[model samples]
Target: MFAGAGSNLSQQFNLPFWVGTFGCAMLTILVSFMDFKKITRVLGIFTPIIIVMIFIICAYTFVGKTYDYEALDTVAQTIKSPMPNVFLAVINYYSLCAISAVSMAFVLGGSVVRIGVAEKGGLVGGTVIGLIITCATVTLFANIDNVKDADIPMLQIVKNISPVFSFVYSLTIFALIFNTAFSLFYAFAKRFAGRNKKKLRTVLCISVTIGFCLSFCGFKNLVALMYPILGYIGMLLLAVLLITWIKEKKNILAENLIRKKMIHLAVKKYDEDLDYTKKDKALFHRLGEKSVVDTEEIKSEIKNFVKETGTENLKPSEPESQSQSSDSANN
Candidate 1:
């Protein structure tokens, strides 16, 4: 979060930019060495911490008096962006996030998506989550005058509640960063590690070293630069996905039609062959001797009749035995 390759320990006196980044990278390396079962248990810690942090922040803000009630009221009337801009932004943001979540689960490597959250049918909860965050953000807007120029506005807001609360927030941020780094780098290393435990450490070390050097570019600048590019790329990806889905559906429908036609033709052919056998045998019996009687010439007539009238319904049936009677022998 600090602008440099690492945290600015001299200025912040806590987690400097470089130290925090490197720390996360180190934790990621540690996680790569761990077996999957251990990783699941490790992930279980993130939810509780996030829940507690959000509840704490929400509770404090709800109880505290707004610094400027007028600014809070004005936020309701303010137009942050044009309606089209907002619609596209929301669509692009959530779709990209969903894709990233899927990709990460895939990269974790295995049949099971270990870190994936199984979604329930309803999405009403997502609306509630948004409302809660937005309400707090609106409240913060009332005090934006105080933090408009600060490096971390939330820190300033939390510190105002209590220094103790600020420290707790700090620790929460640390845990979140470490968890993110661990998941990402573990996935990255796993791809190249390829079941070679001996080479994993070396690969992880190389990844960390490269990342540590990149930290000098500054996190804030990198985020500012990448976001617009990523958004455009995400939109393009969504378009491609939609087109592919449409093509697949069309192909499936065409295949189904072809299959049905083939099945109908096969059934009709079977009926024609059965009718011809019946006619030929009857002619043979008429002469009172076994003889070849061809009925193939009438095949087209049977087919035309079937086409106009349609076939009978098919069902499973048992064979019925026929007994030769004295009347049949005379014929």
Candidate 2:
């Protein structure tokens, strides 16, 4: 992204490409030192700006431009895609995306107050990303002939609409690229350095320097070479996560079954003495739903309830025949 952003700026402004690259590296280093909350706030502000820009560009091209489905088909055949197949391309793209998502997930997971919040965040984030990708793909195919050979096709599309719009969009694109680089690099450095501030700074500097040197490999070429490889690694990560989740779910289901049986048995054992109501049963059912439950602890709790309520001395009512015999003897 750094390489692509810098390449675009250099082309648009007629400046040295290396200058833009160096600037991104310096900005990344400075931004990396700031608190994560500050960085998140900045990204939060730009996210809406990006969404609006993308929508305007897509809507404009679709409304104003001529639709050449025949030309699009021909271009699709003529152009050589980076991936061999569409399925592989999608997987590679998502895998590469998962790297950033996972990185931020780790960082932000700590601040989450509830599992529901995290789940909601993932849902909304995934939906937004899907919409953006779908719109971009539609726009690209809608104007395939025009952007087929362009390095940064989105910018080309915007530039056709207006140079001023192109310039503003370029700044937005740069901030987004910076956001990605800063997140990945910061996460890497934090992981390696742990809680050591001095070491983290050193790691960040070294990583950014190395990344800057690599940006000379031309944005397109680097993406073509690196993204798929990362995607494969990301697939492995995803597989591992899926397997772990399945195992955990199985364990949870087993625990729930055991808890249900235990609660039923405890309730039945004292049914004659203790008056267990619908509310009490609901409470016991809830205890079974927790992540962890101890049968022994539950038994002790039931015993304590019996003692506290004076149910321990309570006995089952005598049969009618026994009661009648006692009454006759007394008479």
Candidate 3:
């Protein structure tokens, strides 16, 4: 971040770029070293807060200003490159601008982010809300000043309304920058932190200092170089994630279909033997009952004949009813 680089404070105080750069980066360093989970959650809310502030500021501008800007404020005067397609041009602008802005939804663990995202109708829904808010903000700020030469156009807009407003807006800007800076630096430092507390602090300082030094290269230059590269990287990551999601869904659907087919086949075989399953209830009770009754009489006859004959081998305690019951149970 440029921090207070082109703000009213820097201009009034005649501060050097290095001063603002180092100050912001150093604050970010302290933020990185903080072991506070509450701080992360608090900082996480800052982006939404920032967006709300933007909406508030936009409303103030609408109510405060009666006259229109003589001309639209253009942030970039020199259009070094141009795209022909209108849709693509808009897409390109947002893709670059959103690099850090949209990092809030990410940066946390993906699963946790997904859980949080679902309540707001998932990631795409949140994005649409963000876009609507962004469009309103752009419409207000684009005409903040007609004189496009000022590096800090928003500062001039608020200043025109009131010094009090300007000062408050400036502080808001600083807070937003600080919040964003904390996230970025902390993310970079946390990677190397692992379990080394002492080493992590040293690395964190060095990293912040290095970032401060890098900031001297100027925010405009960095944005110019970094945005396009980040845009492509973001696109690639999105493509990979979408493709993987599609593949996973396909696998799940395939497994479900196979399972259904197996169940269907098993049911078909069961249906074929449905007649056999109902043998005792359906067929045996009707047709086989008389034959079964005839067999009992025949068994009684045999038992009586065996008893009447002097058969020493057959014990009197041995019952033919037990044998017949066993046969019926087997069937």
Candidate 4:
């Protein structure tokens, strides 16, 4: 992203690529020192603008450009892919993108207090992203002959549309790149430095400087070499997470079963000990005399007991008489 942003700046301003690259790297380092809330605030401002610009660019291209259907299949077949299998290639690409956003997702998820809100956010976010990608892909493929050799294809497409659109879209693309770069580096620093502000700043300086030097490799070269490797690594990480989640769900189910059993035992004990006082009678009468045990009260008591004594000690004990009889029969 740093390389891509630098390329955008160089093309837009007619400046040396290194100068733009260095400027972007320094700006990113400065952003790393800002408070996380402020960083998110900056992102919040640009996100909607970028989204709108992307759709506009796509719409313009779709309206203005005509795709060569006959040539489309030929171009697609001739184009080289990082992965040989098309399905796996798509999976790898998406996995790489998911890995990039996973840390930010964690940060955002932490702030959500309600399951419903998180569910809605995830659904809407995924749908919008998918739509954007679909639009952009169709637009790009439509202009494949023009952009197959270009450094930044989307910029070329927008520039061809109009100078005004080109300028605005360039700024939007830069912001989009900055948003990604900032989030990635911020997450990296936070993961290693934890809550240590000083160490975080230090890591940011070193990492961004290293990244700037590496960006000298040029954008296309970096993408060609880096993305596929990251995609494979992301796939491995995703597999591990899926396995861990399955194991966690199994453990939760087992624990829930044990908890339910404990609650049932506790409820039976409570029902047996009731004195059948007026209060109990009134409760039974209100409940139609079908049952007197308050299952909810039993569940709450079991939860408290587990908190105090732990689940290891919550197993029901056998009756002493039953144990003695079993022992005599064995003898």
The candidate scoring highest on TM-score is 2
Summing lDDT over every window of 10 consecutive residues in candidate 1, give the lowest-scoring window.
113-122
The TM-score that candidate 1 achieves is 0.57
Q: Which of the two, 2 or 4, has more lDDT?
A: 2
- Candidate 3 lDDT score relative to the true structure: 0.53
Q: Where in model 3 is the C-alpha error above 4 Å?
A: 3-14, 62-86, 101-106, 110-137, 140-147, 195-200, 248-331
> Higher TM-score: candidate 3 or 4?
4
Clashing pairs in model 2, backbone N/Cα/C closer than 3 A: none
Clash list (residue pairs), candidate 1: 5-215, 6-17, 6-18, 7-16, 7-17, 7-18, 8-16, 8-17
What CA RMSD would you report for each candidate? 18.2, 13.0, 23.6, 12.8
User: lDDT of each model, Cα atoms only?
Assistant: 0.52, 0.73, 0.53, 0.71
Q: For model 4, where is the 10-residue window of minimal lDDT? A: 284-293
Rate residue 77 of model 4 by lDDT: 72
**On residues 1-331, what C-alpha lDDT tens digit does candidate 1 reach at each position?**
2233144231235555567666666666777677865786677586566666666666677675545577755653453332246567666565554444444455432322111222221144356546555655654665566655444556667778787767766666666656655555555666788668768678877877776667668765655565445666777776876798587776545433332322233233556433334533453334322212123423333344345455554211322101112222343
lDDT of 2 by residue, 207-250 (tens): 99999999999988887799888988999988987898787987
Residues 1-331 of candidate 4: C-alpha lDDT, one tens digit per residue: 7798889988877878887677678778888766787678877787778678778878877775577778976886787777879788878888898899888777665444223456589899889888888888888888887788777888888888889988988887887788888788877887889779999889888888888889989998998889999898889888987898687876545434333444334333344442335543333233221222254543454545455554344434557434533432342
lDDT of 2: 0.73
Please provide TM-scores, in order, for all candidate models, with all chains considered together.
0.57, 0.74, 0.59, 0.72
Return the TM-score for candidate 2, rounded to 2 decimals.
0.74
